[model samples]
Target: MILVAADRVLGRGGALQLQIETVAGDAGVEVDAVRARFPDVLALATAVLRFRQEQWLTGLAAAAVGISEPRDRILALFSYLESCFMDDDWRGCAFINGYGELGRAEPTIAALADEHLASIETHLRALCIEAALPPYVADGLSLLVQGAKVEAAIHGTTQPARSARMTAAMLMSVYEPAREDLFI
Candidate 1:
């Protein structure tokens, strides 16, 4: 239902009440029932946002880290991001969009978005460690991931993913010498 009413939920300056009603109708449920089931709409929306964000992040992590070579892993990650950008249903990062929509109104939603982004950072950090890259490389890659998402969404193009991939390759090259020094 979120996908069905994404325009209403994510579009500029719509009344929350009307958005909820439209979502409820699309979901084939009474608005009152939806309200009864989730009195705190922000919390419910945050949960959905987290779910969607984690889904993509986790999938990307798995695809990246599942490969054997460091360069291959980075390529895998870039490929995944490119595919996401090209997806017909792609509508940007859900957490980012949700935060833009509800962050100021609901602090909990903001916190949830932060937590979700942090989780992605943690996962990327782990991948960096596994790849024997410098610790700070994870942070740079995380920023690249986020920037690519925003750029792709805004421009409706996969160019950002390609650029991010080139950046990641450069970062990996800088840290490649340290690979043998790390215990992991």
Candidate 2:
């Protein structure tokens, strides 16, 4: 039911009241019980944001299987990006959507979303370091990832992920000359 709520809330641009009512109707519970369970809408939104992040990270990890080489890891990351774009539940990004809907009206929700993005950035940075790539590469890739998400949502296609992957491969070639053969 929480998953349903998250999807509806994000899909409808953070209509918390409506989403809660919908959840209540779907769950056959009273609206008051839903409210009692989630006294703070922002808190519920935060949990949904965290849940979305975990979903993304889990996908990334699964895509990165047997990825020992840095170049392979980059490819894996790009594959993950494509998968995210292709997901039936894809709606830009949960954090970005949450921020767009509630950032101005609810600072706490915005902060939670910001923290979630930062966590993703930190994880990507760690991957860059593990790959022995320059530190800035992580930031660059993070931007690419975000851009691809937005583009994918707007175009309703996975082409953005493919484009980003090609660009990332070029960047990787420059960063690790020894791995140039891998890309070819």
Candidate 3:
């Protein structure tokens, strides 16, 4: 529903300029000064920065999809996201293009995005350690999970997430037969 709402807003606004202005206004920010001074490209960069910061909170909270426990939150969020973007043309999506468009103009957003991705990757690596997996295998798992996010977005399906889960389970069977550390 949030994605749908965002899509609606994007459709109605027609341009990043309008979207930024509306978003700023919704947040009760006086963007008039910024709007008057910066060109559309500049404003877009600023909006992208703000958008990424906001996304961090959403990502951490698992978008409030109702799974409150940390482990459940991660699984549910990934599961739903996998289901959400499971479209046939997901791969052809312009995620990189859009990311580049935002990054080229907004260095701050680019930097923050890099930081966020790294933080999340570390979180995954820590989970691997908790599962008692070897460091290299844990790193591989972390990369696999991260890569699945991109794959899910590109393929528009939950298959990537499911694949990640299956792969993780297989690795666990080899490295952690007891499943003593896993909560679920």
Candidate 4:
């Protein structure tokens, strides 16, 4: 319950931005209850981030399930991200927001974010290899998706993903001469 409340706090700002009392109120529990579970905000924040990582990997699997084609599978992942950007319940990624807040100040915090990002990179690299494209494609597409998330949050819209997806498709087609069209 405390983790869920802290996750809600994460959308508005960084993970550690909220006070214990605020999180307690959000959790509908007493401050002591929250403290009993979490000795401090840092502990609570770390737990929430860890919780978010599991959810993210699970969602990533679901996003690509039942999709066989390498390119379509990658695009399906991007489209899933598009829908996620549009979701009203969860605005920004917990991992992104965490790094934005902590930066290099905390190694553990940064690792949490890096681990999540590497998971995305792994998925992208797999698809790129499957399509017989250069490994650089995964790196490029990963940056696009990361930037798209920040862009969507800044503009209060999800057009960034659409634009990024188009750019990705074009890049793939341009790099592979045999494929007439990669854009969907």
Instruction: Score every model by TM-score.
Output: 0.79, 0.85, 0.55, 0.88
Q: Sort the predicted structures by TM-score, highest score first.
A: 4, 2, 1, 3
lDDT of each: 0.71, 0.76, 0.51, 0.83
Judge candidate 2 at residue 6 and give its lDDT: 46
lDDT ranking of the models: 4, 2, 1, 3
Q: Give the residue spans of candidate 2 off by over 4 A.
A: 12-18, 177-184
lDDT of 3 by residue, 34-119 (tens): 35544454445444444544554466565545654433443444464454455443331122334454546656645655665566
The positional error of residue 65 in candidate 4, measured at the CA in angstroms, is 1.7
Q: Any idea how many clashes model 1 has?
A: 0
1 or 3, which is superior by TM-score? 1
> Which candidate achieves the best lDDT against the true structure?
4
Report residue 67 deviation for candidate 4 (angstroms): 0.7
lDDT of 1 by residue, 117-165 (tens): 8976886787687788867788899899889988998998999999999
- Could you tell me which residue pairs clash in candidate 3? 85-156, 86-156, 86-157, 87-156, 90-154, 91-154
Off by over 4 Å in 4: 177-184
Estimate, for each residue in 1-184, the C-alpha lDDT of model 4 and write its tens digit: 8888887877665665667888898999999999999898878888888888887778778988898888887787778779888889666777777788874787888988898899889989999999878878999999999988888877878898899889889888866736456664
List, in order, the clash count of every candidate structure.
0, 0, 6, 0
